[model samples]
Target chain A: MDRLSVPTSRPLTRLIEALNRMPGIGPKMAQRLAYYLLRASAEEAQTLAEAIVAVKEEAVLCAICQNTADTSPCTLCQDPTRDRSLICVVEEPLDVLALERSGAFKGLYHVLHGCISPIDGVGPEDLKVRELLARIHDGEVQEVIMATNPNLEGEATSMYVQRLLSPLGVKVSRLARGLPFGGDVEYADEVTLSRALQDRHSL
Target chain B: MLGGTRLGEADRLVTLYTQRRGKVRAVVRGALRPRSRLGGHIQPLSHCQLMLTESKGLDVVTGCQIIGPLFPMREDLVHHARGFYLMELIDCFCPEGLENPALFSLLVDTLEHLCLGEGGERVLRRFEVRLLDITGFRPELHCCLGCQQALEPVTNYLSPSAGGLLCRACAPEQSPVHSVSVNTVKVLRLLREADMETVNRLNLAPDLAAELEAALRSYIQYVLERSIKSGVWLERLRREFGPNGALGGPQNGR
Candidate 1:
């Protein structure tokens, strides 16, 4: 049977199509979601729709850091208690959240939104690199922590940014790599093991 | 794997240029998770042996073992950018499931050479010429496109649109022809025939190197009908971090 020709209400089909367009949501899952929404109370469905709309409407990129936030500078950037001398550069806003949840470092965050992916047609200019440079022009920041993911694109993005930041005379550091806590050293990749050994310190 | 993208929340969609099958896309289950074993082994530009099972859409990677991580290339920014450029070329030209082991070998060998910190400019030019040849787009460097006469040891025009060299007589016929010197032609021809070892022995004068770079990039851009994204970044890196008073001094002697 032609899947598109299945007898269904137009609105339900539209909902399914919209859901299907989302990443990781296949046709069957979209249909399931649409049907579930149909069975739910009208108020519940309206609330869900309103929440999605509200997120799109309310979320704005922070002017200072380019992170998605409700305000221009973002609460984190405006927080006086946070260390203004330290900046943690991350690939995504979620990473900022992850680092914030850790509570180990009190630093401002700069989200590049994406990494330098050549295959994906993303380059340094495509990212918010110029904005990052502009932020450091005043020389308030002392050190920049490269907290990009431990992947090739992420590392390349970090290096590209680091090259730009070199002339600014700010101390740059990369996140440490080693075996995760409770992970066996035997299973670690050679690169990780090598980095672990190199970064090893006294007990 | 040439590169990969995050899939869903925990998995990864990877593109691998295989020795037997050419370009293949497969899913690495839970590859985004911190402790996923496949995550580290399936990095871009890393040589790996993968166990893939047939699936409905893309293949599923069930097992993987690292062969060469090309770690040294990652240690230097220029080397890493060059590696990405090579991978981008392969990804652009080679179609999926078109088994050409020779092309695959060329990629692996060039990557290995880059990782070993060999002369980058010559190696890249050699790779481009050889890639064009393997993919059946080799330009006619020896003969003129219009008159079919053997090229002379003098100033010539390289018509990217014509996909070859044109003698002074034939130059005006092509829409856009880059002024290529005889030395550039000789070096390009040498790169076409020479092994990686021979290429290592070769050095390019700055002007001649620039001419060759321009001519080849124009040809490649013409062929693809679009510019390679990495090429732009490579140029930027060279400008900012290249030999002339850049962050790193005298990179790869290019």
Candidate 2:
């Protein structure tokens, strides 16, 4: 009820509250960041704000891969050097980057964005799934590599997608599994994930 | 419901909407060509408010307003795999054409956990089990399904085939039951009751996680018979994380 309680800079406090709502950031960290931004040089502070604003405004979603891009088609879909026949379906845009970093895959990708989650209530329709079927239809997509994560949701999504694409008569394959370049097989699971590693024969 | 096809020389855009079978997808043609209007903004995990329209029985994504990139599942292979696994599980359990509100919110929250924190594997496992529970395949975790005995301090005996605990008296007669602690059973029970946000906040050690995983896998396998292909890869991926990172690496039967 006093002057301190009725702070003069309510807007600043409110901003901190908003920042605190972000993932991994707590009230203390948010407060510290808010203060840091406030004390920062005007140019630096303004630039940070602009960067945030720019991603929201300037960035766009590529029409093909559903990946975030500055332009429509995105770089990977446009690249001539990549293999056009292979289509790797993944759960999110970042998966493209993860596969890219592996330097193992040369094919194009389809970003499903989210997988089928039952408890939380996200079904296949909530994801970019149907477009994937359409991709198989029009594109000369010879082989579809399902790159969904190896969890229940990812497996269900992959299986559903595989079944959907099966009618199209496409060659649907999963990623190779084994002990990573340096890993153990003893700690595997009982389902297909471990079995894949156990049965991984030499190419 | 988000799906895409190669639209241009280097561009692609996907449209998502509620599907008759519970998901939908759309493509933007020529979206990848350098000169095309749709560029890097539409890749996986970009949460954008989109402008969409229906044409030729498909939902088309006309435009997008970027919200910001979510980075948790994108930062590495492990996180990526974990996220996909979570999403796919939700997909498998939901019925087509039904707008499952809890599943949708679960996905958003699951991704939020994946991107913002560590221990994604545990969070994911808990989610998987919870998904099964909600979807109605909950294996009886508490008392013995056969004996109807009160499972206090759950002394090591879960029969996947039987779908619940097997007391020592019963274990000798049946195939060797998987061993799980009372604490682990409590955790499983908790998974059945707790919300995803609450589930994500808890700690799940590797050994306990391994026990729960075996019991859960066995129960699911007994029901489904054949194994899910993704389940195998998930095991290998878990091994990749090392023992410290191993919440529940493979070792289903081993």
Candidate 3:
């Protein structure tokens, strides 16, 4: 190894390596974060480390919706005021947060954890699809709103789930696709423009 | 084109199989954002014309225009799965920067055929045979590998390791082999020589289709030294839904 490979200490090098393994964090960014943590006070460093450990130790996937939480069912699944008939399916737990922030729907959610991506070797069996099917079979869910991202893999996953749910007698719907707010019509692609027109609502 | 992966928070890394440049992976800036114009045009299974700028590591996508969306393929589960399988085969077999217009045309044609939902598994069999021919792994369907003798109408063994057919007497003890029917061999030969239109009109019984699928799938797995992910999904769909079980969606009839 060269001089550039050497860190201030072994622990700092180890921290940088660990952080570099995280998604979207390159080696340079990892090193920068590691140094930032090193310069902080001992109390601050300890608190940060404790928080990381606590997240791993305390977090559990909710058995019902598969969302990460401290409880098996999570607060959303346990909430009695939410609509029982409508279940929105999303790709990840983070999506559940995004949807919750929108405050648009009063129904519960189902986290798929991932979409069907064959290139990545991820199939439907790898997802929480069986759990979702079982949940739907309970006869409470009347409609499943597919909120999967509007990508090829996402759409394929949504279609797959919809096929399974159709035979189960539950109504399935996908989120509307069109131009985003503030998006320029001139800049939009033909597909987007067409979809926007097709999915347009009556004024 | 094939598909894309999330690069970072808002960017995407898309893989495209083009006519002149072959397989190219480029980064699309802000492609994950809701309003980015580039995101809508790069959907997998779409035939798109893209303008790319040379960069240090990966090329940057500057512009995109969809030539054909293959909308029907994306709307149906069976077509979607078959289309993905074709993309996966090209991705695995075709190396980057190698030009092969014939293979590219074969892919686009097969995708279009799948979109029409006319040929069913026949389209895939033709694709596998053509792909093998293009990649220089064309299986020895007409002759036996062991004796270099012409194959008979009787049952033959396909040796994935030997990269061809083996007669009953010549089935190699040194390597693994799969039982291939005479109809499977005849179909493979026909698929290799016939045009896409011919393949679209040609149909096989359920048992023959299964045999053809199994034989070619084994050969592909052997040549690649790995199992195809989409193949597994296709097989699962067949088992769960029956031979053509992945049909049905809002856009497709049950």
Candidate 4:
């Protein structure tokens, strides 16, 4: 029998179910969260609810890079110090945050929203690819760094974009693949090991 | 086995084709984060042995051991595209929860051949014929679909719409029947029953390979009722790589 199915108020059960639907939240965790919310003061519950509502109502996709932002052009795109001549193409908004955390890339970013996966029925047309092309055509962009994930679909997406950008005179480059910092060679797979060997640098 | 997709930040949803259970999608926690233990093993087309823990909706991938990642095939653009096409074809044709060890072995062998740098067109043609055979969609190469007569050693038509071959006399006038040469028909027949060794030894002229590819692709399209996406990428890569392409070229180094 499901633990959540035990006698409970309708509103409490509803909250548990809603929380259960979220990623990484199982029934047990959902029940705990729901009961915790039930015990919290009304003002605390109202604040949490209002924050969720505000995020949906206020957060918008930036017109330039398609990243989630409160304004048309995100702060990264509008920032005067960022390199305007280069663009880093990634798969999702989360990737934008990951790259930003690295503090390595100073160029602007274009989120494709998703990768090209035929099994999932996601194609090039489904992504924000045309917008990227248009950005390249209309802007002073000279180089595009394909920062899509290091997977099959990611490689395919980067190659597809590279082909499209090749004739347009934009120098296309993919992120360098090697041993991740602190990654042990003994545990590295053949693909990663081979990549690391091929991309080895002179000290 | 095919690869996986990132799920919920640190987790990965891997799709595997098992001999006993067929296609299984399992979630592996902490697969995407740095220093992930499952990172190197569950890559796309890795051919790993997975231990799954049953759960509601989707199973969790608890353990994995890499048998073969087919790294060489993944390194080249053309080969990678072909490998992707093969995986996609299997995923489309084979339904979930259906056990067919023969088909599983066929996939493994075909992927191995692709990694070994065998002629891609021949390997693909052989894989198509064998896949159709296992799936019960094998086209009749010897007899005519319309008249049931033995096909003459002349130019005959392979009709996708009719689900097989048609003789010159039985072929519809305006229908989209692909004309196949005597050599093409013979090669297709050879691929159906022959092992990879036998098929590998047979060198196909560029024109014949193209003909075989078109005919088989049409039949596959007919079977699926929709166009294959990887096929489009394969065609584009073929054009880019040229006739002699990157079949035996230097590894693409990922």
lDDT of 4 at B172: 75
Question: Which candidate number would show the highest lDDT if scored against the true structure?
Answer: 1
Ranking by lDDT: 1, 3, 4, 2
Using all chains and alpha carbons, the TM-scores for the candidates as numbered come to 0.95, 0.47, 0.95, 0.81
lDDT over C-alpha atoms for residue A143 of model 4: 97
Q: Which stretches of candidate 2 lie over 4 Å from their true place?
A: A1-203, B1-21, B34-42, B46-52, B66-68, B156-163, B166-177, B195-201, B221-231, B238-254
In model 4, state the lDDT of residue B118. Answer: 70
Summarize candidate 1's per-residue lDDT along A26-70 as a digit string, tens digits: 888899999999999999999999999999999999999999999
Better of 3 and 4 by DockQ: 3
Off by over 4 Å in 4: A1-40, B7-9, B18-25, B49-65, B95-101, B154-163, B168-183, B194-211, B221-227, B232-254
For candidate 3, lDDT tens digit of each residue in A43-67? 9999999999999999999999999
Considering summed lDDT, which 10 consecutive residues are worst modelled in model 1 chain B? B242-251
lDDT of 2 by residue, A1-203 (tens): 42222443776687677787786566677778888888899999889889999999989888887888899888989999998899898888878888889899898899989986533446667898877777787868899998986544566567657656777889998775433344334432223234465576778
Question: Could you tell me which residue pairs clash in candidate 3?
Answer: none
lDDT (tens digit, per residue) of candidate 3 on B145-168: 898898889999999888899999
Q: Score the docking of each candidate (DockQ).
A: 0.63, 0.01, 0.72, 0.30
DockQ score for candidate 1:
0.63
Q: Residue by residue across B1-254, what tens digits does model 2's lDDT show?
A: 23343443444445342312345556665554323333334545444455667778655667655553554444344454555555445445565456655655556666676666544565666666766665667777767776888776746587766767777677766674787788887887787777656665667665777777777777666655655444555565456445434322231111
For candidate 2, what is the DockQ-based docking class? incorrect
lDDT score for residue B157 of model 3: 97
Q: What is the TM-score of chain B in candidate 1?
A: 0.96
